[model samples]
Target: MPVPPPLRQRILITGASAGLGREMARAWAARGRDLALCARRPDALERLRDELLAATPSAVVSLHVVDVADHEAVDAAVDDAAAALGGLDRVVVNAGVAGGDSLGLDGAEANRTTARTNFLGAVHQAESALRVFRPAGAGHLVFISSMSALRGMGGAMNVYSATKAGVSALAEGLRSDLVGTGIAVTAVHPGYVRTEMASHFPRMLMASDPDRATRAIVAAVEREPARAYVPALPWAALAWPMRLMPLGLYRRVAG
Candidate 1:
């Protein structure tokens, strides 16, 4: 019998322009895997593609300008990237926004935008990924959640936390639905990575740089765990207590 072909890993990552997503693209490409990179910033995407190719001339990096909030655009971009990559081996739903309202504030628009991007946007990606994987009988669905998703967060983090919680639940549902199927689903909860999104913070809590976080993420992803905490240090250990902390204490600590 003819030998089966080697596994092809054409990974698709959203929000690949900057932050953790950009690091993931660079890290994955360094391993000689072809990548499908998408982000809202076309210029940044092109620059990243150039950087990746320059580092490893043999790597395949396809760029797409995409706004994850646009469901139709997400579908189209994913389809085009999968086609270019000869079918996707993995889809990382990494695009997300951290802004939202504080209670008793007029930030409804901010919360809505966050909801549309973090929750609905992720839903669209999952649906698109399933379409590509179901027939092919294989694919990895990676959801980028946050440590804040462990419980309802406060203030500006409220909606962001809620959205991540939604995605985490979505990942679990997908896992249950896809059991015994070739398609695998994983949820990664990353804590305080040093990214532009958190640049304005007075100080990050247990912050790790993007490169280190990406290393842990890539490792966890390769193992295809149902759930993982990137860098798996204080965050994994901290999650339990953080969830169980009384509201008053939590508020004081968070404040």
Candidate 2:
């Protein structure tokens, strides 16, 4: 039988204090993988670290409080975390926030924040992870892009969609550049995941739980697929039509 991939390898995840990031940390910890978790909230990180350590005493888990949007802080955090883990086998850049209220006031600031965190922050994490992976010669880089990246969703999600689209492009381009380097890049496009991010949206649109989304993400990373559309069928199907729809119709439908 072929040897299975080792789940004991060191894995680093950002935004692991809550939502999909937290769930991914839990899922990986259950598999006995050593984890280095980062998020803005130290208390939440410490709580999760304690919980995971209590439940899985054999797993090595360390939590760091750092915002991905802070380039210098992320640089230092990633370096220290990788050192603590001896080396990183996988880095999941999951720290992100939805663009500000697209429909109401504060839209401008929200869009700006969205761009800063979603696009620039992702770039920072990817660059930092590559710095580590390039020297090591092998690693996995998992980017948590959204299905919103597939098409421009006008009205409330315009900036959010643009940011995700940018990151998706970044992931694809990096995958091409990393060819034959033994490093794998996986872009995850998840649709309507049930999390605080979707709380403001209509309930009918939500499809999968955070745990379910995390499972798909972890599976995609393990398989080292070029791209993954979570909750597969319907979300994947929506991608093409969204891209081809007339601008007027797309706006009406998305709005």
Candidate 3:
């Protein structure tokens, strides 16, 4: 029989201070998974750590404050997490931003910020995570992309969708390159989930609750699939239609 991959005991998640990241930490902690939570806020991280420890005293929860856009800082934080956890079995590149405006309508800085945080930040996290995974010869890397990645979006979602598309592509490339290696990559494409991130967005139709969304995403990650459309109901069924929709109608609904 083929040997199965080891249980991913130690998990490192970026953007873990709040929203989906925080909820994912809680879910994994309940499962007795040791976690390294990385974010820009120390207080939030500490609060989450305390909450997890209170709920599951045996779970080891580490914290690291980091800005994912800075490759050097990502390197340091990821390395630090690995060291603290005695080596990382999994890394979830979940940190990202959703701020953007229409091209020409807004300054380049707005779009640039989104690009740096969403796309480049993912690149940095993947690079740093691989440094440890490659040496260890085993690891699971998960990327939290979006349903927006299925097709081009309009208005503020344009840049965000593009960034997610890049992330999905990155995950696919890694999966291809690491075919023979024990390392695994999973791309999670989530539709609008009720969270602070979605609150900032308008026109979120049939959005799933935070708990439901977290469950779907965590379940998909555990499966270590090449790509997953989370919640599987509407998002999975909607992917093809979204891709095949007429541009005029797409723009109307997407906007």
Per-model lDDT: 0.90, 0.86, 0.92
Write the candidate numbers in order of decreasing lDDT.
Answer: 3, 1, 2
Clashing pairs in 3: none
Please report the candidate that would top TM-score against the real structure.
3
Best-fitting candidate, measured by lDDT?
3
Segments in model 1 whose C-alpha atoms lie over 4 Å from true places: 1-5, 201-203
**By TM-score, how accurate is candidate 3?**
0.96
Q: Which ten residues in a row have the lowest lDDT in candidate 1?
A: 197-206
- Quote the positional error of residue 45 for candidate 3 in Å: 0.5
Question: How many clashes in candidate 3?
Answer: 0
What is the C-alpha lDDT profile of model 3 across 74-165, one tens digit per residue?
99999899899899999999999888787888647878999999999999999999999998899999999999988888788889999999
Query: What ranges in model 3 sit over 4 Å off?
Result: 1-8
